[model samples]
Target: MSETAREAILTRIRTGLAQPAPLPPRPDFTAPVHPPLAGDDEVLAFAQSFQGAGGEFYYCETRAQLAVQLATFRERQQLGRPFVWEPAMQEILRAAGVAFQADETEFLAHADWGLTSCEALVARTGSVLVSAASASGRRLSIYPDQHVVLARPSQVVAEIGDALRVMQQRYGTALPSMVSLTTGPSRTADIEKTLVLGAHGPRRISLFLLEDE
Candidate 1:
């Protein structure tokens, strides 16, 4: 080979060697078997985790019991009209003789409580899976002083994977704009490492689980 040709080939080889090699593909675990969804076990696990994360859990079997619970809660907290985002909640409030408004965002801003239905309550992590596309908007869950969730026993799932499957079955290929997995109230220890509640969202989160079918 001519000297110029040999040097050109060496320069090309050197340039290729200087480039970094690509990283390997991430590994995927083999399909692991998970236990069947046990209703009682799931509820127990969720309650434990929820209370541990500073959340209040109320289990009621009847509507009358729920009404009484709300009445006591209202009297103790001295809460006025609450902002309700879901139709089911509106119906419940009307039946319970409680006042609620869904007219505007300003109402929700000053509202003491915000009521909404969750897509799923995850047992493994005690998370409430919420979708922006649902009746409960993004603000309803985050803006109110107290974020109240009205969930049914049928909505409770075994794990996050099951919760995701529920969403998939609900929305199909069309997904929501935003999905949140809230485990507890809005808390942060960012500043000075001192914990603070209601820093970025509601100070308190309460879940009212209904044993309704």
Candidate 2:
């Protein structure tokens, strides 16, 4: 329009801007969006959700049990020798009388079963949060045909958000360059809408929940 109409609009806008508008109340970011599960309930929820996502769940009440269960699983599945680079996991494997090759070259050549430790486990979505910060880095969880994660009960959380918070506290300002959540075996339904597992990564993902305080 006209200059008169534009002036009138400008004057109205100026008058409106003279008065401050009330701001909406701030949200409580600390509050969880969903109800949180705790203790054994949280672990149980994770087991159920993880299994629903086509993940194998093994609950070991003691470290000895974890070792024996893992040894038996490896034998039964014929997974060959596992490749673990994490020092803690290597120690566990050694204690369990499990043979694992830690050489990167050997792992790359024979990537059969890869064992790793996870950052956190989400009970809500049954997702395992892993970071490149670990000695195993990124490949151990994805390259192997059979990927096994050894997690402690203390690492289980109620939801993804909770897991993220825990990670933040653990890592502080120097967070990992790469962080990923593996819900289960890599899957996709891209071809003719047919579901396919191991489409982009490991075909099988197993979680060994070691009951450690």
Candidate 3:
């Protein structure tokens, strides 16, 4: 065969061997209504219930208050102190015992845990979705033994659809690298129909509800 023909045949063979599979369809999203903010006592009660399940909850009136609570938790949890936040939070974390690093590489390499703000929470399921585009690494929510999330009462939606719509509007064509629908801690019941926790993700999930602030 001529060199050109030989090359053509080889190219055809390679193409034939390659898999041509259609991509999975994007998730269908339907916006749902926001849920009314849980009463302070109700929120507190929910947190108390999770305590028995190895979870913690904190309530704050403002972002400042939440940051302070987080700092304290990090210290108590021995998750290393945070040094700097993006802006207003940096100092608070530093004071609480967090050591700041220069970049994400350092953040993950040394930090024992992480904290991020959430877009919304589903009151119906008590689930929260954290987006990677929000500058929060997926690992922050998954890799750590403990995950601390900050959510506002106003962001509590009635269903997952509401959260998805907020995401669609925020990111448009470019979806976040990851969207985690976290409800409680990771758990599984695979052995003898026995329930187990922390199978694939954090053993503990903490949420700070900022209502007034």
Best by TM-score: 2
lDDT computed for candidate 2: 0.89
Candidate 1 clashing pairs?
none
Residue range 58-156, candidate 3, lDDT tens digits: 888765676677767767887764322234335434543545542466665665656667767765567778877655556667776677776666776
Highest lDDT: which candidate? 2
Name the TM-score of candidate 1: 0.79
Minimum summed lDDT over a 10-residue window in model 2 is located at 31-40
After superposition on all C-alphas, the RMSD of every candidate to the true structure, in Å, is 8.0, 6.0, 14.9
Q: Which pairs clash in the backbone of model 3? A: 61-213, 81-97, 81-98, 81-99, 82-98, 82-99, 83-98, 83-99, 83-100, 85-90
TM-score computed on alpha carbons, candidate 2: 0.81
Between 1 and 2, whose TM-score is larger? Answer: 2
Superposed model 1: Cα runs more than 4 Å off: 1-28, 31-40, 105-109
lDDT of 2 by residue, 1-213 (tens): 999999999999998899878899999998878765655588889999999999999998877888789888988998777888999999977886778887787766789889999999999999999999999998898899989999998898887888899889999989999899999899999999999999899999999988785
Write down the TM-score for model 3: 0.63
User: Which residue runs does candidate 3 get wrong by more than 4 Å?
Assistant: 1-55, 82-110, 211-213
As for candidate 2, its clashing pairs are: none
Candidate 3, residue 157: lDDT = 63
Which of candidates 1 and 3 is the stronger one according to lDDT? 1
Residue 92, candidate 2: C-alpha displacement in angstroms: 1.5
